[model samples]
Target: MSATTLTVRQQLVYEKELCERSFKDFIRLAWPHVDTAEYKHNWHVDVLAEHLQACTDGRITRLLINICPGSAKSLIVNVLFPAWLWAIRPKTRVLSASHSFDLATRDSLKTRRLITSEWFQRRWPIGLRNDQDAKTKFENDSFGAREATPLKSITGNRANFVIIDDPHSVDDAKSAAMRATAVETYLTAVPSRLNDPDRDVIICVMQRLHEGDVSGAILGRPDLDYDHLCIPLFADGVDRPPTSIGWIDPREEGENMFPARYTEKVVRGYRASLGPLQFSGQYQQAPAPDADGFFRREWFHRYEPSALPQHVNYYMTSDHAPSGNNDYNVFRIWAVDHNRALWLVDSFRKRCTMDIALGLSRDANAKTVIAPEGAFALIRKYKPRAWFPENDGTWAAIKSMVSAAMIETKTFVTIDPLPTKGSGDKVGKAVGYQAMAAMGQVHLPVGPIGDEALSEYAMFPAGKRDDQVDADSAIARALEDVIPAWLPIIAPKKKRSMFDDDDSRATSDDCWG
Candidate 1:
């Protein structure tokens, strides 16, 4: 068959290739300085294009994507999308919102120009749309678009698609108040501008940090739930490579994306060097694991408690993670045996009070407790055999009421192995994760482990949050001192006797037999 006689399916595949190739061209040719295809965005943008088409096919309405930054996310949301919108829903009124007016305006200009470009003109005939000084409108479709200002109020009698992209800038990402204001704008203002609820759709593309920004607000809703497309590019689910996972995981000091996401050599050398936040957000596509805290998923070994060696001088340590209607506070009891092999023996994470927490720990035969000062008075009420509170901030002050005699003086909790914030918990979480992976991912203990702790910790790092793991880390740290390394101490059997004889103690000698 001749080229002109190609089937519609063939033509579509060709068009898709064109669109994909065009994206590459747009990045390399149109805007060389702004390297677009290097990071998480290749998958993000690809999925986005597919989803928009899926919308055309009546598949889904809300398309929610959570990714880190360097991924060419904006190109899909801001630059390529408006044109895509026009293609899908001709003359569809499109309203785009970003964190700042500048970003929104710049993106609007980009889309508007692309449509009027020689490339766009090559695809769609000239007579269909009209352009007037940076603003483009398709009179045939009754659709027009311009950059939106900070919404005092959004009035849209003509908007067919409301696309909210990056509602908070990198700066605003650090501020909770700013994030909250953005959320308010989305909830209160954006809807005021919607013209067609039936045909109109809302697509939010953002990197989630604090739960305050417009994207976070939209994400918080259950009824208005949208599709969540997580494009974790760097080594799949790893932050850095040389890691257990993720090719370029920071844990491994990846030089660059060797098998890079978008294009093999799309990212050149590290320009200047990416901030930890930017690296994880943009290229890696991982949300910051711990925004404020120092610890993250990379801190422990994927250990199984049952496999942990059995030896004497084994003491259990407890520093629980809290749980409630909202947060899950975990109470973990880790033990180290005579061989100095640390095992996370039991865990207790629940939405109950101090009484229940201590009872759970004691019943599990937890011998030592190291905790945040917040648990001092409550734990003291239960009288655990030993206690240790984290030695930071006012934890020292709480000693008077906490009975320092009951608690260990030294506290060794490594939030992050390194002391810094702002980066994704790649390094800290990774080290811990490698430690856990090298050991055991989860513990399925054989006897007397708290069921709650077992369930939570076992489901951990993968359980949508990281509470149990933190407790495990504390327990692991406490094990460092308690485990016998210098000299093994064997308790002397007092007043020998017939019962102490190996031949007489049939039950105790059963394992050897």
Candidate 2:
């Protein structure tokens, strides 16, 4: 019966049944008490609710939702979903976590407010156990429990449903250590806490903070089989792939995710307020900008392996952190062709202690230091003419080690000390190579190596690491020094006088030669 035709008691029963059957109905009914402001309903709310209900039905065990901030992700997934879930299955256990314990507790408190409200108890009547109820955790009469904790400190806790909300703070996401810790925690700690390995649910909700954030980790690992729901602030016309439960984002291209609140004007304002990079990550749900950063993506030219010129001379450049630094050790091998173009043949990048990265010796007795196989393999295959290590205090050690390695392998190559500049000129060092790339003279071999090098150049100074690009600069310096011999000089054509006879005119090539 319609609400207008039903009695007061009948209406209450009808509403309770609707709340139980539809998660969206639960959100609409529970929104008022949780927020002082009025609830502005939107279509994305239904999309979120549908996927979440699929989680409840055991159709989706792993779900990742990446949405713009202020879209009520925490409210729907963290606060309201748990309370509503308890109404449906009071025996369920949930462990909600955030980047900070305080943030987790904040959502926990909101969830508690809704469960304890008179409206909730009158319908569902899943009373909270008075003795077990607390700020960070609580238990219900049906043995259902909810706990809150930070992502880093989830030891000795198990749950049927693990909710990770905003595990990386926007401010701290820039730190490599912080991003690594978040990814590590999600990989190592998050999975072990599932009470039921076969049927438990893991729901991660957050904006895209970094390329290596927890969301990135989940999508990168195909073994996880996560159902990802990525809804940026503005739709780009690309239909989101259907979830296991068959829910796809319905917004068309260029439509705002939540048009009820964020209009085109408001989105424009946000783009201006938060610069391109920040807006791209948070609002667009993209860790990198759509366009290029310091280096244009189009400027990177790809070369086929079989098309490489045989007359090219190869050179290798190595860059690493000085003493007491933890920068990555990067080695790049470039081939300079007869036309003065630089082709990136191969590269090796690793982050470790100096001793482990570049071992001190290659002797079989010393297990701590062995031949650098990755670098040595390139040397053996390409037979670079010279190798350039930064001209620092350790250059002599590097030279001696490579020389010994070459002798053992019977490979001939020269080891040279690369010139250096002041510490503040890291970006300046890459300028020469960047200019060459802009002119399409620098070529990168197509594969994982090329993809990685292009990504490093795309992020450049703002990226997490720059050892690869810095090594490119060294290659540029080497090419400048050696290109003159292999490349033919083409001087500009000389101007001719109008009175000169046609037969007696000297050929244009003769004057320049």
Candidate 3:
């Protein structure tokens, strides 16, 4: 029935039920300012709404959404979703955070405005506590509250739904220290605030930034089991698969995801202005190109786990970082085959203090001692021929610590300090590593860690973290001359003309030396 045909109480109940049943309807009812002519609501909106509705139904406890900016992501998720939650699930508390406090407060204010709007109250009858009405935080009469904060510790605040919107700013994403801080906040600070850890949901929505950004960290970890909803600006037909919610990008290949909003012309302009790297991350939802960069992804050859040779020479190379820095200590095991191809056997990386990095043994009791495993376990397992530690400021201190620990544990292994190289020289070494991989002389063991190493290589000099790449560069420098001079370069056979003679044939010496 139309609004005019219904009784006063009947109309109220009808509107309330309509808003609760359809979040899209609720947006239209609550916000009269949306210009349909310019807004051009697309199919992706319904897809997003469906996934969010699924969140409330407890089907998804963790969600990470990567979408191009200006797709109304913040408006749909940050502003509308929270207020809709209050309408249906009246006592659901929400904790929202952004990279900056001002940004968080802005969304909070919009949500507050929606909740207090005449249309919203007429239907849902939810009221905000008079004394608790604030921009950053507010409490409803039903005991549900919405609190917004910068990406930092939210002391004593608890919530049923934790939402992180754009946790890393563009500039902050380029800095390893800042990216680490953002990831730490997401990993350590926010998860604990959930009122119901098992039942409550956490949603993170942002454009990808770096390989170590929060989105990257979430996707890399399989234990989290996040439901990822990626909406790139252009449809590659496979960027978004069929989600459990039965919503997928329906656009064909080469079509714009939201053509009316981000047209072909606009997208082309973005590509030209943002450059390949930024445009790929921000618009394509992929931080690095698959086959382009200083280190091409296709060049990192993979080997079957079962095909590994038993008797190959092994060596360990490391990249170290002192405490208080965000860098990770990387330990990599490399195997050199008889053909001199370098195989990445194993790797371990962690952001830890010197004690943990070294795996120092400590006294547990009067008769008991506990030996933590870090690099020590890898050394014991692989028994590498030598350990090459980068010759940086921390080299001497690390060598001293390793020596003292070895003497105590009676585990003797050769320790060699890598030749000191300046920051500019490391890039050149990375180029050498890239060249080695391109020549098929570098092989990677097939696994998730290997995939991660390849991505790091592909985004080298542009990625936030480079500890893995640095270790690979160290190994490349040490094994630069391992390729045998006797190895034959087989060139394609050239069809001989009747007039051609043996003297015109190319010799093996004419190949690349």
Candidate 3, pairs of clashing residues: none
State the lDDT at 458 in candidate 1.
35
Model 3 CA deviation exceeding 4 Å by range: 1-14, 33-37, 236-254, 297-390, 393-422, 425-455, 462-468, 471-513
TM-score of 1: 0.54
Sort the candidates on lDDT, descending order: 2, 3, 1
lDDT of 1 by residue, 353-416 (tens): 4434443222245544444332433343332333433443333343343343244423323121
**Which of 1 and 2 is ahead in lDDT?**
2
Model 3 C-alpha lDDT per residue in residues 145-193, reported as the tens digit of each score: 9999998756579999999999999999988799988898798888898
Q: Compute each candidate's TM-score over C-alphas.
A: 0.54, 0.77, 0.67
What does the lDDT come to for candidate 2?
Answer: 0.82
lDDT of each: 0.49, 0.82, 0.81
Q: Would you list the rank order by TM-score, best first?
A: 2, 3, 1
User: After aligning candidate 1 to the native by TM-score, how far in Å is the CA of 506 from where it should be?
Assistant: 37
